[model samples]
Target: MDEMTWLDYLPVLGQGAWVTVQLTVWSTLFGALLAFAAGLGKLARNAAVRGLSVAYIEIFRGTSLLVQLFWLYFALPLVGQAIGINLRLPPVTAGILALSLNIGAYGAEVVRGAVQAVTRQQYEAARALNFTPRQTLFRIALPQAIPEMMPPFDNLAIQNLKDTALVSLISLADLAMRAEQLRNYTQDSTTIYTLVLLMYFGMALVLTAFMRGLSSMVGRWRPAQR
Candidate 1:
């Protein structure tokens, strides 16, 4: 066979890139939902709700994401078997779960901080208007907080994108795994790795731009702080 050139590698790498994109998109979407839920939960009046949210945020944030991924992909099934349940997840599902949980934990703090930063007066105004706590949070607090959350959320989104490479460890054919496979077959480490680096950079750039636009849109809804 003719020696595979860089051009020849594009198709395979592109496939891997698509998988990486899917992982990032799904994980980030789910992570954002978890972040809002847990973040707000931690501030809830219900002790049990607050405790559960705290526990989730701490457990995922405190642990190594790589270990979490391994535990989900490798250990959970064995635990399930011992308990007479089938808990095995597909590699892609496992990867998304781990990434979402990990990023969500960190993003939870961002949500909590931003919400808390909403001036006390805002809450007072809500109370004056007879707004229920839920009304206060959704109508007054989150709208303001979301704009603040954007910058950190953008960082987390990019971090999540890069972190998708870890899924390759579970034999998900994401970009990094594809690069490794190509390197093994081609023995052209320099070219393959360089291309991989460039590809990741390109993806990050696009994600950053998207996040910025989202941030701007959300910021428009933020009422001017007194």
Candidate 2:
């Protein structure tokens, strides 16, 4: 094999970075949905709903993300066959699902905590106005509680970006996977790995900045919007 310059690897890595970005964006959006749903479900008045939400949160949070990825990518297929169903997911899908579920579990707690932190007086005021529970939660409580969720949501967003590296192990051709491929071909382990590390750091910094902006916007929310 011929020796190649770092510039030659950029194109390859860029492609991988694009995939990583896509994974992060899609997973974060979907995961936020799950987080909100599970979080609110935990606060639901019905015993069954609360139990289901608690189970999902505990199961995902308690397990290793790596293990969760492996189960989805590897074990689920076999389990599906045993049940006469198709459980095989493409690497991309599995990666996105696992990352979302894992992060959503943690995000659920952040949501729960933020919502619970809302003052009881707000609810009481809603009650005095004869507002239903749903209206009170949707209007009076969430407009305030959502701001509190921003800081922690930012943290989780960054964490999810880093977690994308694990997806490369499942052969998703993300930045880390591209680095490994280059290192194997060129045998330039140090330079290749260093570049990969820098790429990840750069992505993380960008994500953090974006989340900070979002948090600032959220912070500016007025009760008048409610």
Candidate 3:
């Protein structure tokens, strides 16, 4: 294979790149949901729940994701044998779970901070209206939090997209893996990585546009876009 064949790898890049995007999108979506739940649990008055949520957020945030990936991909099997429930997941599954948990940790802080930024006056007014805590949270507080959360959430989504490249290390055949294979076959590291970089750049551009659109939509919902 030669530099001329770089063009031949474009379709492969597209197909492999999509795998990265899929991992990020699905994992981030699920992770954001989990993060919100964990964050809200942290805010709860129940000590045990708050403590557990705190522990989870700290442990995930404190550790290196690469290390966590190693543990999930390698270590769990040793411990799994004792329990007889296999923790050995495919590279894709392990990647998803690790990324999701990582995102959930950071996302938990984003959720907590955004929720806290909701004004005390709003909470008082909701109280005056006799709205229950749940109603106030769902209807009043979270509405206000949306605008604030949008920027960070968008950033997190993009960050996760980039981070998904690490999944290729586990042999998930993502963009990086495809790039590696191309380089190995062609022995042209320059063009191979160049195309891979371009592929990543394109994906980031698309994600940025989508995120901007989402921010606009959220702003409209908040009556602040005007």
Query: For residues 1-226, could you state the per-residue lDDT of candidate 1 as single tens digits?
Result: 5699999999999999999999999999999999999999999899999999999999999999999999999999999999999999999999999999999999999999999999999999999999999899999999999999999999999999999999999999999999999999999999999999999999999999999899889897556644
CA-RMSD of model 3: 1.6
Q: What's the TM for model 2? A: 0.96
Residue pairs whose backbone atoms clash in candidate 1: none
Regions of model 2 farther than 4 Å from truth: 222-226
Q: What is the C-alpha lDDT of each candidate?
A: 0.96, 0.92, 0.87
lDDT per residue for candidate 3 within 67-117, as digits (tens), equals 888889999888998899887888988999999999999999989999999
Q: Whose TM-score is greatest here?
A: 1
lDDT score of residue 211 within candidate 1: 97
- Which candidate would rank higher by TM-score, 2 or 3? 2
